[model samples]
Each structure stands twice: as C-alpha cells, then as structure tokens.
Target: MRKLILAIAAALPSAAVAGGYIVPNTNPRDLSMAGSAMAAQDSAGAAYANPAALSKLEGLNVTGGVSLIDFRSTWTDSARIADGQAVTMIPKGAFPFVLFAGYGLKLANGMKLGVGGGVNIPGGGYSFWPGNWPGRYQIVTVDRKVYGMYLTSGLQIMPQVRVGGGLVYYRTTEHLIQGINFLGYDSSAELGTSGGAVSFDLSTEVQPLKTIPLTIGVDYKHQAVQHLSGHGHFDNPPPALQGYGVVDQPATHVLTYPNRLEVGASYQVIPQLLVTAQWTWERFHVYKSDVFNGGLGFSLAVNRDYKNGYTLRLGGEFQALPQLKVRGGILRDISPVRPETLDPTLPEANVWAGALGVGYEVMPGLQVDAAYFHAFYDTITAAGADQAFPGTYDTRANIWSLAVSWKTDLLQRRK
Candidate 1:
C-alpha cells in the first residue's frame, strides 16, 4: 500500500501540468489578426486585450464570439522500459466563447470615461490517451476548463493618452486519470478538483503624435494562485492490498497562473490599410514545482522548472470596399515548457502559425467576422532529463472563429 501510494503521488505532478497551455485571444476579429489588435482599438474586445483602448470608442460597442479548436499530438517512447512504442492523443474539439460590452460617455466635467464588463476563456484543454499505452503510467486522460470574468474602466486623461484597469475573476476545474502498476496488477487513480481566484490587469495607450497615425498600447496581467480541493479515487487494486490505505480520500493542490505583459504598435499607412506588430511575455519561471497533498497523511512536490516564454505577432487589415474588410497575420510562439519536463498530457512546443479572415457589414452598426488559423509545432526529443519523460513529441492544432459586433451612440445620447 505504501509503494502504491508513493507511485501515485509521484505521477500526479506530471498530470497537474496538463491544462496550463495558454489559449490565444478568443475574439474572432482580434484572432483573425493573429491576436495583434492590442493597439487597434476599433473593436469591443479591447475590454480584455487592452482596456485603455476602450476610451477611444465613441459610445456603445459590443462584441460576442466563439472559437472552435482542434488539438492533436503524438508521443514516441524511446526508453528501454517502453521499447520505442508510439501513441497518438487527440482531444475532443473545444469551443471557447467570449462576450464584451463597453460604453464611453462624456461626464458633466468634460472628462471622457469608458466602462465595460464580460467573460472569456483564457486557457484550458482536454486530452485522452489509450489506457493500455506505454505511457499510461504517466497519464491516461485530462480534462480542464478555465473561465475569466472582468469589470474594467478606462479614462481619457489627455487627448493623446489613455489608461485603464480592471478586476478579474478566474475559475478552473480539472479531472485527471492515470494507470498505476502495483505488484504485477494494473490499477488506476482519478483526481478531480475545482477552484477560483482573483487578479487584476492594467493597460495604457498612447497616440504619440496626431500626424503620425500611430498608436502604442501596453497591458499587464498580474499572477493568480488557485487552491483546489477534491477527491482521489483508486480502482482495481489487488485483493491482497484491499486492507491497505488504497481507499478513496480527499486531496488538495495549488496552481499558479503566470503574469503576462504585452506591448503593441499599430500604424495606419493609408485610409484603406492598417498594420500592427505586437510582442508578449509571460513569467512562466514562477512555475517551478507542483505540490499535492493527500488527506491520508502524505504530501508530494514535483519539479517543473519551466522557463519564461514569449510570442511575436504581425498582422494587417485592408478595407477592400466600403462594406468589406480582409485580414491576414503570422506569429511565432516560444514555449515555456522545458524539454526535461515535457510530457504527453500537454505536449507544448514552439509554434509558427498563420491566420486569414474577413469581415462584412450586414447593415449599419452591424458586422460579422470569421477567421481560420493553423499552427505548426516543432518536434522535440528529450533525453537524460532528471524529471522528464524521455521521448519524441510532435503536435499541431487548428482553430476556427466566428463573431458579431454592433456599435451605436443613440442609446447613450438619449439621456
């Protein structure tokens, strides 16, 4: 029983890392531009991407969107224990949604202010591997979900400068299953937990020169730590181990989401064309380890040793006609997961992605946007890592987005 408990505890840390991969911007308009719209304050998604941009809006602006994602990966175990066995893992399609509404008003004192609130999915995913696969001991299945709700306010302090801040609430849920080998008997362990946390973000936008037609935007998100508590259930244990401490029990864990910073600049070269370039940095180094506590009087800490990561994006939008627009962009994303700690549950790697999209104005004050994005992940081979699963990993993903947006000043001016 003690050996079984130790083995299960040792494996839990790897499973805990499953859902940490960050999801891109959920707004289809922003997504179509390869998520490079931080300084392009023409849409309501600014509530989440860069709240300060909200001040640039004239009156009432709203956007609602959905993103459908397909994630695929494969792992090949080269270690002697597995004898070069390969397996494929595919998560069911994920559909994450977003909704944001913002209102800009002129106060009696001649000050401009914008207020907004909404919800979005920032990160989370699901993956399943065959129970009998060579790496089943590491993980079999992982399902995770994360949701973010925020209330933001932006102030146009000066004709050329705007600033904003917001309070955000994050909630997450996870369920994990992994195989356990005990005394020549095959068993399984499952852990399920849900938790919530609160954090904040700040943003600033500057139009350095009125003649330059250039805008620079910066946004920062604070880190958040969530405490999760749930039950750990052991199944199919041998009869001889029935009397041991292999029964179901409560469990607890802690997860620290990383702090993020993004800076971007957009320039309007002509009345019909606009281009943007953005850079994002995440403090993933804080994710050094994961600690798990089982109510049965034992605890385990596993090392992750993740490094900081970044992404570079460039995109452009063209006003083809009075009622039509076309967009395209490219991005390079550097992963935070180290080779020594890479696992199949979430086989994250450096990625290169491209996106194409279009927007149509159905009528006055109403528009629809759609986009398609594809990611090509670089292959990774890890060997001689102390805590890593030695293997070769390959992964890729596809995302499709659709959205609708509306804007109007009549509602706010009626008063």
Candidate 2:
C-alpha cells in the first residue's frame, strides 16, 4: 500500500520533466536560425539570447512574437499479448503557443539595458492519453503552465568586451492524473500544485581581432528550485486501504530546473553573409529524485538518475536583397533520460532539427519575421526497465512563428 502511494507521487514529477519542457529559443529569428543566435546580436532577441549583446544596439528596440507548436507522440506496450498496437497522445487544444516580448534601450551615457518577458511551456504541456491505454497505470493526463519574466542590463567595459546579467522569475502550475490498480479493482490518483522560483543569468561578448567581424559569446544560467504545495486525491481505494494513507490529503514536492551554459561564435564571411555556431550544455543531473510529503505523515522518495544533456547548432543568414534577409539552420539535441530511468511519462529521445525563416523590412524602422521549424526524434525502445511498463516511444514536433520588431534612435532624435 505504501509502495503504491509512492508510485503515484513519483509519477507527477516525471510527467512534468519528460514533456519536452525546455524551449530552445522563443524569438522567430532565433528559432529560424535553430537557436544559434547567441553571437549574432543584431535583433531585440539579444535581450534573452545574450544580454551582453544588448550593448550593440544604439536605439530603443521592441519585439513581440508567438510560436505555435504541434507535438505528436505514440507509445506501444512490449507485452506479447498487446501485439504491436500503439497508443497515441496529443495536447488537448489548438496548437500550443509560446510567446515572447523584449524591450531594449541604449542610454545617453553609452550604457545599454533591456527587460524581456515571455511565456514558456517549460512544464506546461497539456497532453492527454486514453484512460484505458496500456500505460494508463503510469499517466493519463497532464496540464502544466510556467511563466517567466526577465530583467537585464549590459555594459561595454572595454573597446572589445561587453558583459551583462539578468534576473529571472518563474511561476508554475501543474495538474496530473494517473490510474491505479488495487488487486483487481481500478482506481485513480490526481495531484494539483503551484509554485514559483527565482534564478539569474550572466553573459559576455568579445571581439578578438581589430579587422575581423567575428564575435564570441558565452552565457550561463543558474538553476531554480521550486517548492510546490497542494492536494492529492485518490478514488476507489479498496476497503482495507481506506485508512492507510490512501485518503485525499495535502502534499508537497520540490522540483529543480537545470542550469545551463552556452558558447557561440558568429562571423561575417562576406558583406551579405553571416554564420554562427553554438554549443549548449544543461546540468540535468540535478534531477536525481522526487521526494513527496503527504498528510498523515506519509513520505516517499523515488530515484530518477537523469544525466546532463547537450546541443549543437549551426546557422546562417544571407542578405538576399536590400530589404529582405533569408535564414536557415540545423541542430542536434541529445536527451538526458537514460534507459534505466525511462518511463512512459518521460519518453524523451535524441532529436535532429531544421529551420528556415525570412525577415522583410516593412518600413524604415519596422521589420516582420516568420519562421518554420521541424524536429525529428529518434524512436526509443525500452525493455526490462519496469516490470509493469515496458514499451517503445516515438515523438514528432513542428513550430511556426511570426513576429514584428521596431527600433528607433532615441539619442539621434534628441540631437
């Protein structure tokens, strides 16, 4: 009975972590370049991509955008009796949306600063699976939402070096449902929670050579630890299990968002061509376990054993016309989830992605950007990972984005 309760508590965190919660880039131009915009800091997105690059701007800048994400996934039980039938799952509404907005300014004193905010699906993928699916015992439905706000500042301390930092605040809400089997009878468990955390990031940009149009950028984001308190409800427990911590009660848990490091370089190979390459690393190993505390002195812990993950990105932009820019890029993202810790709720695998985008100057100080991105995930087959659940998992995703940016030289106007 205690074991079953622990399993219910454990499933909640896995569901949140395994839902592709991390968004690579929210800006349309950055996404179009496969997230390789760290060093090419010409857009307002530099506020989030590399705050140090904000120093490069000479005016007031604002950018707003939205991304529509379409995610699809399937799971197949490994049991012989189940044959090869697959269960499909998808988010429960119209295509999910990620939003971004940024504001930047270059002060009269030559100092630069920016404030950016956005809505990210970090843990908020409203995925729904059939109640009778083979993996129902693990997870049935999950609804989560996370929001972030960024305040940043940048300074060019030297002729060739710029440094910056930012503070981040995140708020999250989660609700999950999973099926339970008590002997032959069927039951269900539900958990709801909400919490917030604060974190920070630092960045630096450097120009090494006097005659070269090359810039190197490095950025680091600290980890955030969230403590959530909420309620847990269980239904249809057997008569014997009614009094044994099986009742509805208050619950609490802690979840840690990983820290990250990104290093990138951008160079202008020609007057009309710019290229960028970046490498990103995330410390996912912090997600070692889930500890849950419930009413009636019920406490349990479950191991996750996640590892660190990394990504490689390559991108380029070509000035095709005086008023138009063309962009394309590719990326390879490696997952941190291992076979030993694989769960139906966290079916993640390595992926390769490609993107294309275009920016058109609508007016002297206004531009419109649009992009399309697609990700191909490697199918995963996990056997003997769990006696109750073993299966194959496949996933696919696509993103479409649009944005408008406006910039004006405030100092120039004063002069």
Candidate 3:
C-alpha cells in the first residue's frame, strides 16, 4: 500500500487542480470529442473508466501505459478587486501511468469472466500566494490533495450482457496555511480522510432498436465514509465563529460520488464510421456536510439546492485511414460545489471540455495514444481571496496529455 501510495503520489505533479478541486475527470485518452470508447477492443483503460467493459477481453491481456500531462494557469484581475494584478503561476504537469491485466474466461454457457486493478488520481490540489495577490487570486497557501484507486472484476452474463464491480479507495488531506503577508490573518486549518469501499456496475449490449447497438451501464458506490479528524485555528474569526472552535470533520465531501446511472448507445453510421454517446448522473447534492458535517466537533449542513451533478459525452471515430484513426468529442459536467462554497482552498465550477485524440496501433499490442483537451475556464471569486487580502483573484487551467501502451497476451502462457 505504501508503495502504491508513493507511485500515485509521484504521478500527480499536476493532477492536483487548483483550489483542490479537479475538473476534466476522465482519462485524457478518452477525451476525444464525444467521449465513449471508440476502441472497444482497447480494454486496457477499462478498469479506470468502465470495468464492465473488461468482459470484452477475449484472452488475458496486460496493459501498461504512462501519460505525460502538461498544465498551465494564468490569472488576471478580471474582477479588478486589486489595483494591479499579475498572472498567478503554480506547478504544472502530471506523470500518471496505468497498469492493468484483465482476462476473460469462457464459461460453460459461452459467458466470460474477468478482473483487474488500477490506480488513478481523481484530481485536486491547493495553491495560494503568500502575500495578497495584487493579481486575481489572493492570500495564504491552503493546500489539499485527493487520490483515488480501484480493484475491479467483470462477468459476462450473456453474449451481450456484462456486470462489473470494484473495491475502491479514496484518500484526501487538507492543509491550510497562512501565506506570507496574507492580510492580517495568521492562522490556518487542516483536515484529511482515507477509507475503502465497494462499487458495482452493470452493462448490456442490445439490438432492440434496429440499427442502434444499445449499451447500457449503471455504477453505484455508497458513501460509507472514512472519519476525518483535524484541527483549525483562526486569529480573526468573528465572535460567533470562535466558540465551537477547532473544526474537525469526517473525511467526506458535499459532492460525494453517489450511486451513478449511465446509459449509452452506438450506431454504425457507415461501413467505417461509428458514433457513441453516454450520460452519467449521481446524487451529489445528497452530500450536504462539509467534511465537518460528520465530525465530532462541528455541525454541517447539506446543501438544500445542490444535487448530484450530471455529464454528457458525445463523440465518434472514423477509420480515416487504415493506420490512422480520427476521433473527436465534447463533454460537460455539472460541478457539485457552488462558487459560493468555493474556498480559496477548493475552487471549481461546472465544466465544458472538447477533446481530440487518435490512437495508432504501431504494431499489434503496442500502441500510441495522444489527446488534447481544451477546458473552458470558469471564473471564481472566493471569500478567502479578498478577505485574506482585501483583493480579487480569478483562475483558469489548461491540460494536455500523451500516453503509450504495450499489451501482453497471457492466454498463450508465454514463459
């Protein structure tokens, strides 16, 4: 576990999004314009995106790939709370590698069974200027990190139906630091949580509607939480704020990933063209507590109007050439946390992303996958921004990632 933690930690140089909130949650490889698996045979990434898809593996296949992601963010005084604003710079890039081995066994009734495991960074980070950012974002280095992982299995119930499940683990830590010259504030807060749980998914391919090949999948992960314990201090909190004291909360979040529902379908638009789209939803708003909600020290309120967010991904792939595959996709996700709840420590908003990528099978199991994503920037004005420095801040981040794959065949039992 420690080694796994170290590997994952070393992988996320930029996986940590600013304000400790991550947008563009899907693997960059899947970011093509309409984001479903264009290469269904490419089950290598299934453990992270759709475990049920593992049933598609005909034999034992092992895949190991690494992605190099570059990120850049620049902030200006879009709100002009400051007299002169500068571009706030943070660390950039991520080095995430994926390794998984899945095998499908032929059952008595022509069914198949498979399993795999994967480690991924779900995304989140902390950033702050020591002094009041004369630019967009202002004050104190409040940093936090969130990591995710999965160990999974799949079963093909029928020739076209499959179900998969995973034992998932999530770890998060919040660090609140009073940056240099951060207003008159000299105190900060800290919170962290780690736990393991289970999640399940079901998928089926049907020919019910003539030309449409329907693929429906559902995923569910309950909020059987990990308790969070931490302490907080504030030198200038209002009198109503100081009594309850150092806040200690459960390691939980308001946009707690709830039971998710997914439905998708694909159609053969032409002899060589395929189109696919998928919809996913979770009752994120059900999470009202602010990590402090379930802790022994404080009272937290679930958001009354917040709901689990939703995403719509659409894309298609065309065999532009025998060796060249062209793909494009568009994705939108309703961010769970409101801008109002966005702390300088955690900033996020609904997201809109367009992706373009291609995979070239250099030779059989050896492949090269490259993807580029353009995520529309969302504006955030946090209380922590101006309050900590009596100024204003706005932030935006851009991402680009490339990956390589080498899949090993295990069915032949090669020595």
Q: How many angstroms is residue 29 displaced in model 2 relative to the true structure, after the best TM-score fit?
A: 0.8
Please name the candidate that would achieve the greatest lDDT relative to the true structure.
Answer: 1
lDDT of each: 0.81, 0.77, 0.52
Q: After superposition, how far is residue 392 of candidate 3 from its true place, in Å?
A: 6.9
- Please state the error at residue 389 of candidate 2 in Å: 0.9
Model 1 is weakest, by summed lDDT over 10 consecutive residues, at 10-19
True lDDT of residue 275, candidate 1 = 98
- Candidate 3 per-residue lDDT over residues 149-248, each given as its tens digit: 6777777787666777677766555554442222453333333334344444444444455445555555454443434344333344334444453222
Q: Kindly report which residue stretches of model 2 are placed more than 4 angstroms away from their true locations once superposed.
A: 1-6, 13-20, 91-126, 235-241, 385-387
Highest TM-score against the true fold, candidate: 1
Clashing pairs in 2: 124-144
Q: Across residues 216-280, which tens digit of lDDT does each residue of candidate 2 receive? A: 99999888898988888887788799876777788888877788899999999999999999998
lDDT for 259 in candidate 3 is 52
